[model samples]
Target chain A: MGRLRPGHLVEAGFWLGLCLFLYVYSFEFDKNIEIYKFGASGWPRAIILLMAIAAIGQLIHHYVKGDETSSQIISAAVDDGSEEAAHAAHHETVKWYLSTFALLAIPFIYMRVPEWIAGTSEPGDAGLHTARLIVAAILIAVVVYFIRHHRVRVMLMLPLFFAALLEDFGFYALAPFFIIGVMYLFGERRPRPMVLIMALIFGFMLTMFVKILYVGLPVGNIEPFYSIGSWVVTVLQ
Target chain B: MDAFNNFLQGSITLFSDPINILIFLGGVIGGMLFGAIPGVSMLTLAAILLPFTAHLSAEQGIMLFSVMYCTGVYGGAITAILFNIPGAPENAPTAFDGYPMTKNGQAGKAVGAAVMCSALGGVVSTIIMMAATAPIADWAISAFGPPEIFALVFFGLAVAASVGAKTFWKGWLSILIGLMIAVVGLDPVGGIERYDFDMPYLLAGIHFIPTILGFFAVSEIFVQAEKKVRGSYKAPKLSVDFPSLSELFAHKFAVIRSIVIGFFCGILPGIGATLAAFMGYNEAVRWSKTPEEFGKGKLEGVISSETANNAATGAAMIPLLALGLPGGALTAMMVGVFQMHDMQPGPLVFLTSADLVWVVFAAMFYANCSILLIGFLETKTIINLLRIPFQFLAPLILLLATVGAYAVRGLTIDIVVMFLAGVVGFFLRRSGYSIAGIVLGLILGKIGEQTFAQAMQMLHFEWSGFFDRPIALGLLIAGFLTLCGSIYGAFFKKAKTPQTPDPDSA
Candidate 1:
């Protein structure tokens, strides 16, 4: 038996805590009916109990055998041995935490700020549109700065941002920029092929999903973009 | 005879529509393209297209998936042989002998064997699937009650959890997490919410489509993006030569053995094509006269692996159709498709949607045959798709995933759920947990819970009543034994000494 790592203990403890919380929460469910002895909470409670047991068993097993097997497997799956070593060298750096926080927070800000601004103003107010544009510009500048330095983090944050803005900005108004932005982030420098690819993808989505399938893809809620989205759909139909 | 008649009638109806023929051919081509790419799995394409299935007829939708499943299993062999990259996990075994052959300048012969054996295995398995599915469903309809069904689900989850993880405990924990996810909405029996926390979206239950997309597609993009940052991909030179009839005839017995292994393995709930491929290769090596030649460019190795994986594609559908138990993630997504069409899989589905079921059978059979022609003609063209960088495709895939998630219920919340699931899946994969086990648990948990409640009610809430039913008792015992075996292997087995890390290995 070897010594367990702190990371292993934390992972095991997370599962144990989660299972315990859910098990306690299951008590809030309605009581058992006449025909059913255990009712709605029974199945979840049973599952949670098993999960807690597994978590405890895992903690003990790691304590006895160490996490070498798991570490090797994870390292192998993620990268070459040298790359894993490199990752380990900087695993505890503040840069990693900051990058992850930025990746998560950018999308939250992108999705929430507009709603916050809209909540304070009337729907058709000109000031609301201007505020949104200013916020969007600042966010885009921040993303561009990160893209120059932390390409992988920006790659991850791009999808989250896309999801956050997709419904409000609409598919047509937002998709081409997304395609170009992603291609550019990926180091596709040539503008011609990027434009061609963007057009092809945009056209395909419009034809297959909107024209043929009649999927109610969102048009933007705001002016100009909203009219543009509807106009394209109307033309396509 | 009735099954054969149903199959014939299905062929007639399917061929009657030019549009169906077009969709079938398109699915085959699309499946191969997706599967041949290193980063893209057929599951990504399937998840992206799931929303569109709602607009098509049930036959078209199911047939599209059926053919894709058939061709996708074979398409991965192209990359495995030529580039040393297994397009999907199931194709990983092929690269052992396949890449060695490529290095030896015998890539043509390796590919030829893979194509022939894959088609043969798939066709044979489809025939078996068609013959066996109706009878199995009939037997299940006759024999299985709520208790038996619950026990079977339990067995399935246990076996699912036992395979495909760094340890049995991690696998089991993943399954428990998935079951917890499934328990979020209103309870099936009493309609009492378990974990909804008073949100209307949560009350309807988390839709599985977004979860599937997030776990399989978005997480895959994240994985690939990290790889892209670490390394560069190069295109492989393509060469293919079909084997002579005489050459193929020499390996007929190996092919037969693999087909048998693959089909049977595919039928087992939660065991899928990846296991079948490895098992086939293992059995081939065991039976070979010069077993030492297997990993060193033996054609039998390629034949066994490709054959078994493709064979499992059809057989994997049997459990999904007969008992509504999906053997893997792709089939689990198929369950979502079935629900999207307002149909439930299982015995009653055969009674209600016989035509659709038969069409799927015919489509799979035809899809396998089409692979023979298409694999021969378009091997080079398909390999060309690898030239497109993963960076370019990642955003497009994310876009599709976003739309696919939202289009399911026209809910923005589903998109959020999908992204969250993707992040969770990425971390889960990093930690060496089985995403497939989690998925299987999510799909089966509701059914298991419903049946458990009904079974308890029928038995007057006596826990011991399950033991009175022989089939239920047998299944429960099997599940218990599987767990015990996993525990024993985890603890009682001697641990291997840690070795120095190999710097060159990727």
Candidate 2:
């Protein structure tokens, strides 16, 4: 049998980790001794066990039958062994990691930052606190690795950046800047078209959403922008 | 006569209101524009527009989304004909003969044929849906209990096998993952919170709209950003060369055949418009005396694909509107819309929300007319629509996806969730797992659980009672057969045979 592919290992590890979490978490729910049927944790525990079995089945199938489903799809999608294809594949793998790390970091920070800022970490929830810290540290390490390798692009960070800054800066303040950042990352050389396009699109959005439809959006927490949003709402009304 | 009256009343209600007319037109034109753009699908547009629809009355909301759904299919065909890039995968078959026709300087002719046939197909299917919906709904209401419903959902889940993934196991795994995600929130019977991990956001479970945005729109942005997007294309100057009445009549047989095939294909779970189009094309090729002309700029090819693709749209709605089992991803998202409006999408909805049902029917008919007019008039301009680079487009999509997710409940955490879902969706697709299967399971999971729980209660927790209801027993057998067949097909039948990528199978 051939050695297992990296994908196989990664998938198995993910399932195993998830299974462990599920098994541990299930312990928190007290079984109702009166009833014979499964309780709250029963369904989830059953599912997790089935998933682990499936993962192991997958691993065994890969080794025994020499499964090549993932690699075949990759080769099919890429379709060529040329240097450009290889480069593109490499870049795709990079983007995938970038996405994974950013997904983990942005949500963790967004949820934890407010509490962390308030110094709400307590010994009572020390384990949860430790878990959060480990996730944050791993995210930071991923970011460091990307920077060191120069694989990180501005566009890759745009979503995470927007998620981080959106609440404080508000839609009015941040949307145009996000558009500009995206335009720059997409390799736009001309400033004139970018500005013109941004204005047209954002202008239409503000009028339709805020002025006409009266859809609520975040107003900037800081001074003049808050006033601007209030004035716009007032004027539109 | 009563059904006809209701249908007429629905049309009048929509037409009488100036705002409804405006929204209908906007939905059609906008749906087309979104579908015509590569990497921007009708699903993306509908999901983005879904929150906005909440402000409208239920009838108006139904009309807007229905119009969008109908026109979006046609929109994808426009780019498929012009640039050889399908705006949606379902339209991919159109590019086979469409690009050749474009190369032959019949771009206008190709566009006209595609637009006309798409309208023809959609109109026919809408008529079918209109005629079929009430009877089917009546039957469903009488036939199905909780056990039968569970069996039906199980069948729906089993349809994941037909999703044309690289391997069936991968697709099933994706569904399992989706089911796992679905069960993350409060448990049904006792209301005990499951996997919220102490976060308030998990209380209601993962919101459907944000999940849809993350899976379809945001993941597309990532995929588009990774590829090198060229901003320029060589194209002939366009004009509408709409087929003469006689010319259309000449291909009536092909169009009719395609309509029938597409409608039936749409009714089947998991096999969607993409398959319909290819089936239509293949059938046309098989019947044609001049089969060699098919890939070499045949108008019949365009008609067959465009007709079947659009026809499938209305046909797919039958199962969704009647059974509450979405036939494909697009309708799966529509289920979320129904949930958004606090309407459950089963047979009883026809009784409770009769006006909304007929409004959808009327909106589809009007949307097809709008496609006919706009598609003809904008043939020249529509070709220019392809000039927008993925660079500019990707950012706009990301922004829209973010805002769409946030707008659902005006929550920033939803935005984060959207991005997280997007990342997961991206990796899942890259790894050869079918997103459709995952989406099906996600949308159906809660319904499955609820029905199963109710069934257990009804049976007093006797597992054997599942097989006691004759209709439920039959459906359960069917579901089992489908699952076993899929497993056999995925492992034994397909494992040894390397298959090429077929757009129709996609």
Best lDDT goes to which candidate?
Answer: 1
Off by over 4 Å in 2: A2-4, A30-36, A49-89, A92-153, A220-237, B229-240, B243-248, B289-296, B494-506
The CAPRI category of model 2 is: acceptable
Which lDDT tens digits does candidate 2 get at residues A103-181? 4565457456645644665523545444544554564455445532232243445576567556545677778877776
**lDDT agreement with native, every candidate:** 0.79, 0.73
Residue-level lDDT for A51 in candidate 1: 93
Q: Assess candidate 1 and give its TM-score to the true structure.
A: 0.93
Worst 10 residues of 1 chain A by lDDT: A71-80
Off by over 4 Å in 1: A1-3, A67-98, A113-133, B494-506
What is the Å distance of residue B376 in model 2 from its true position?
Answer: 2.0
Worst 10 residues of 1 chain B by lDDT: B497-506
